[model samples]
Target: MALQIGDTAPTFSMVDSDGTLVDLSALKGTKVVLYFYPKDDTPGCTAQACNLNENLDYLSSKGYRVIGVSVDSNAAHTKFKKKYNLNFSLLADTEHELVNKYHVWVEKSMYGKTYMGTARTTFLIDENGIITDIISKVDTKNHSSQIH
Candidate 1:
């Protein structure tokens, strides 16, 4: 089933690029901007990540913490973060756990070829863990503005 606003966000515990454990259940009292992207360092993903990073302070001021999820390895996430000086946590969902749980993994079509990939999606979860908004068509360049 597709996740919708007011549904409880799926809980996850995964290691981030910095090797720090990020557990969703542990962040109960904090609002979260949970985003799923295709891959680390890709053009669109990079733009989205950088845009969010650049506007992180504004998002933080609104009491939201950003967390990015991808099926990339921790090493790849580390390199991507270092390359862009990203300040938010990039969770390495190498096992496809988070992607499947969040239902972002889907069949995609490009150039007449069909393949499985992570759909660019964002879930805005409130302090109590209930999803407040779902951004299916994300604007990579102005993502933060779309969040509010």
Candidate 2:
């Protein structure tokens, strides 16, 4: 089932782009923007990541810690972050645990062929760890303002 607003976000720990282990529980009491994208360095994903990066100040001003997640390796995340100067942390869900927990993994069709992939989705978790909002149909550009 898709995650819903008011549900406690599934807690998971994974390596960040910096290769440091980051636990979601450690971020308690801070509004969080946890986005799940399909991959790193792809056009749509890059645009979405950069859009958020460009509006970090506004997000922070509203008390949110923006974090992106994908089924990518830490090394891949590092390169992607550096390539785009992304200010947010990207969690590497190599095992797909978080992806499954968040229900972003699903059937996708490209060129009329079905495939398993992440559905570009974003969640707004409140300070208390409950999901405050969910944006399943994310628009890559102007995503930050769109969320707010």
Candidate 3:
């Protein structure tokens, strides 16, 4: 079943670009902007990540800790983060555990070719871990406005 507002966000323990462990359960007291992207360094994904990074301080002022998730490896995330100077955690979900749990991994079509990939979705999780909103139609360049 798809997750909805009021549903408790699934807890996850994944390593970030720096190989540091990030556990969802450890973020209980702060709001979370858990965003899933298809790939690192892709145009749309890059725009979204950069926009979020640019507005990170504003979002943080509202108590939202942004965390980007993708099936990319830690090495890819590190390079991407450095290239963009991203100031947030990019969780390496190479095993697809987080995507599957969040139900963002789905069939995708491009150039008439069908494949499985991550959907660009953002979950607004409240301080207590309950999902307050889900942004399925993300505006890559202005995502921070959509969240905050």
- List the global CA lDDT of all models: 0.94, 0.91, 0.95
After superposing candidate 3, which stretches have Cα over 4 Å from the reference? Answer: none
Candidates 1 and 2 compared by TM-score, better number: 1
Per-candidate RMSD vs. true structure? 0.6, 1.0, 0.7
Q: For model 3, give the 10-residue run with minimal summed lDDT.
A: 13-22
Candidate order by lDDT, decreasing, is: 3, 1, 2
lDDT of 1: 0.94
Report the C-alpha lDDT of model 2 over 1-148, residue by residue, as the tens digit: 7778899999988778887777779889898999999999999999999999999999999999989999999899999999999988899888989899999999999999999999999999988889989998899987998777
TM-score of each: 0.98, 0.96, 0.98
Per-residue lDDT of model 3, residues 45-70, tens digit only: 99999999999999999999999999
Candidate 3 deviation (Cα RMSD) = 0.7
Cα deviation of 66 in candidate 1 (Å)? 0.3
Candidate 2 lDDT:
0.91
Error of 3 at 47 (Å): 0.5
The TM-score, computed over Cα atoms with residue i paired to residue i, of candidate 3 is: 0.98
Candidate 3 residue 118 C-alpha distance from true site, Å: 0.3
Model 1 root mean square deviation, Cα atoms: 0.6
